[model samples]
Target: MSDYCGGCRYDPKQRVGDHACPYTAGYWSFLARNETEFSGNHRMRQPMQGLHRLTDLDALVDQEKARGSIAP
Candidate 1:
């Protein structure tokens, strides 16, 4: 089952699976394309912040590991 648009499926013939997964490249492209107006949007703001904070994934992972968040 596809997870596009709140777990709803779109037409496979017209759209690709990339549009289904929220983490897909196409999804980010969609978000980037629609970012300007979403500044005031509730959900978008936090993720935008997360996107900014996640720029250093490796360091975040290392920090989490240091904090015993990851299983060895």
Candidate 2:
């Protein structure tokens, strides 16, 4: 919950329901920012492969949750 981008440190509420939603931006940015850290990690390699093609955050979260990577 930032004031600019949800993934960034700036999530502006006004940006919330738009195509450029902060959550979306933040989500991608989070991945980009941590790609290297995750790429070689045993737990993230498979899921990381789906990042670029994943547009549904909830679904992605659910998938990861099912894999036991995310906390319930």
Candidate 3:
């Protein structure tokens, strides 16, 4: 999953994107769902570091908001 050089559309390296991997999907959901309770821990900070690299962060947040509206 580390390599994006293959034909796989999803990139496990990214935090959020159309080509983001399953880990990102779950990670984003966890973060969004627990935004208030989430803290700046070393473990969380490690993976979240890459989130700053995403150019379309707004779009990713929008996607989370939309998902929240549809969720029960």
Which number leads on lDDT? 3
Q: Give the lowest summed-lDDT range of ten residues in model 3.
A: 63-72
> Each prediction's TM-score against the native?
0.36, 0.39, 0.43
Off by over 4 Å in 3: 1-26, 32-39, 69-72
Compare candidates 1 and 3 on lDDT and give the better one: 3
Question: 11 in model 3: Cα distance from truth in Å?
Answer: 9.3
lDDT of 1 by residue, 1-72 (tens): 964555445442321232322233333444444567777899789766654553444443444345453543
Per-residue lDDT over 1-72 for candidate 2, one digit per residue giving the tens place of the 0 to 100 score = 644443554434322233434454455545754788898898887767767566665554554445454466
Pairs clashing within candidate 2: 2-11, 3-10, 3-11, 3-12, 4-10, 4-11, 5-10, 7-26
Stretches off by above 4 angstroms in model 2 are 1-18, 54-72
Q: Which 10 consecutive residues of model 2 have the lowest summed lDDT?
A: 11-20
Note the Cα lDDT for every prediction shown: 0.47, 0.55, 0.59
Provide the lDDT at 5 for model 1. Answer: 58
lDDT of 3 by residue, 12-43 (tens): 67646667665565566556555445556766
C-alpha RMSD (angstroms) for model 3? 4.6
lDDT of 3: 0.59
lDDT of 3 at 62: 65
lDDT of 2 at 4: 41
